[model samples]
Target: MNLNQYIDHTKLGPTVSLAQIDQLIAEAIKYQFKSVCVSPVWVKYAKEKLASTNVLVCTVVGFPHGTSTTKVKIYETKEAVKDGADEIDMVVHVADVKAQNKKAISKEIKGIVKAAAGRTVKVIIETAYLEKKEITSVSKLAIKAGAHFVKTSTGYAPSGANVTDVKLMKKVVGDAGEIKASGGIRSMEDAKAMIEAGATRLGTSSGVSLMEGEKINGNTTY
Candidate 1:
């Protein structure tokens, strides 16, 4: 498959600068990646910079951690969509899954998805912190909650997306929603492996190097 089409060129570090956002937009446009994912604060700027292009502007809500209240996540989703984010990757509360609180999980996911209006909502289940059964369970809940996609990780976890996780997520989702494999995907081989395991999208801070068919080097902040 054409990998670029599935790549969501991302930079979600806490210390990202406007200059870096400019560089990210430039690289995204140059490489023709599907989208440029950033924090909510940069969504408008990224949207403006890429207004004349087909590249999408994506932003995160309740990022890195999914412990935010449902109300906060809903508000974040609305604000992100208002700020010109074409897609919202909202993290789901990991505690809900660990506690087996399916009702709360469903309620939270629904609230965020509803607040997104018509914008695409990708529910980040933070697979690294979940067991295999939790992965399948949450994937089903995401689909039932009206999420457009079920994402694998936040890239801030101890581990990120793996082929086995992707396969399990896809099996659970089963065309009900798309799967985005993210976090720690830093090479062409890793990207391909995720896609081969049924990832419709790949999120990485190493998009530039991966697109260039190289492994990321140095202490990158993504």
Candidate 2:
């Protein structure tokens, strides 16, 4: 399947520069992917850069690490939305979940969802750190907490968006919500597979390169 529409052309890193965000916006405008995902710090600039275009602006809350306090994540979500972020992707507290502190994780995600104030909220589950049952429980909790999507990873983890995790999230959320597959999805094949496995959204920095390679080379295996 053609997976371009499922992409959120992403660029989130510790050292991502303003010039890089501009370039990301430029590439998003050129490619017209679903959106451009950036860090919360760059939301304002990313919003300004994307203002003229129809491309949506997305920024993360709780970020790569989900260790932030619930209040902090909520505050980050509020500030990100105020800065013009069209969508909020917040990381679910993996530690809380792993410790069986479901209440804390639920509260954190719910805070972010409410902070969104009706905007789209995607909860990152960081699947690499969770088992199958944990994945199911988190998906259910996120859905119950009013999240619009369940995301697979932070990309900073040891692994990202495996087909197994995608399928698991898909099974749990089903038609009630959406699933976003991210991290380590660098090729057209992986992107397509994620979509097939029920990922409605894809987050990756390799979007432009993926398309370029597809153009320069046919569907033959790389």
Candidate 3:
């Protein structure tokens, strides 16, 4: 598949405004990116902006923190979908997963997945906070919970997706669910490495820069 075909050109931050989202949608339209992941508050606007295009509107649930109650996450997921979000990226309950409360973690994921109603739901395990073994176990729970994809991070963590983490996640989920390797993917080389590591999707804000990097420096600048 084309590398750009796997990219979700993301630009989600508190500093982002409606004007910025307009620019983002314009960029997504220009690049023909696979999707545009935005904050939930602007999902409606994003949907409206991209209504005429083929791009999908993706929103985050539980956001950078994955500690929200299941009810709240479900509510958020439902609201996003209602607002025209095509995909929901929900964070996993890190504490529950780390404490070995598999039931609670699975329950949380299942609730959100159910609320998504078979829409593209990607469970963000936030791999930055877990060990390799934890990543594998959590991925299994995410898949078992009926999530369509297992995502790496929220991009607000101290670190982001790594080649090793993607490889581990891929092994756990196998061919059942997609793997979304996000965060810190700033170059085509980095994106390629992750794809080789089994990442079927990439979430990155540096997509333009990565495309720029694809330009060889054989000649002088214009």
RMSD of each: 1.3, 3.5, 4.4
Candidate 1 wrong stretches, greater than 4 Å: 218-222
Model 3 lDDT at residue 69: 80
lDDT of 3 by residue, 2-90 (tens): 76678888888889988888888888888888899999999999999899999999999998788788899999999999999999999
- Writing each residue's lDDT as its tens digit, candidate 1 over 49-150 gives 999999999999988788778888889889888889999999888988888899998998888888888888899998888999999999999999899999
The prediction achieving the highest TM-score against the true structure is 1
Best by lDDT: 1
Residue pair clashes in candidate 1: none
TM-scores for the candidates: 0.96, 0.93, 0.94
When 1 and 3 are scored with TM-score, the better candidate is: 1
Kindly state the number of residue pairs that clash in model 1: 0
lDDT (C-alpha, whole model) for all candidates: 0.88, 0.85, 0.86
- Name the runs in model 2 displaced over 4 angstroms: 214-222
Ranking by lDDT: 1, 3, 2
Q: State model 3's lDDT.
A: 0.86
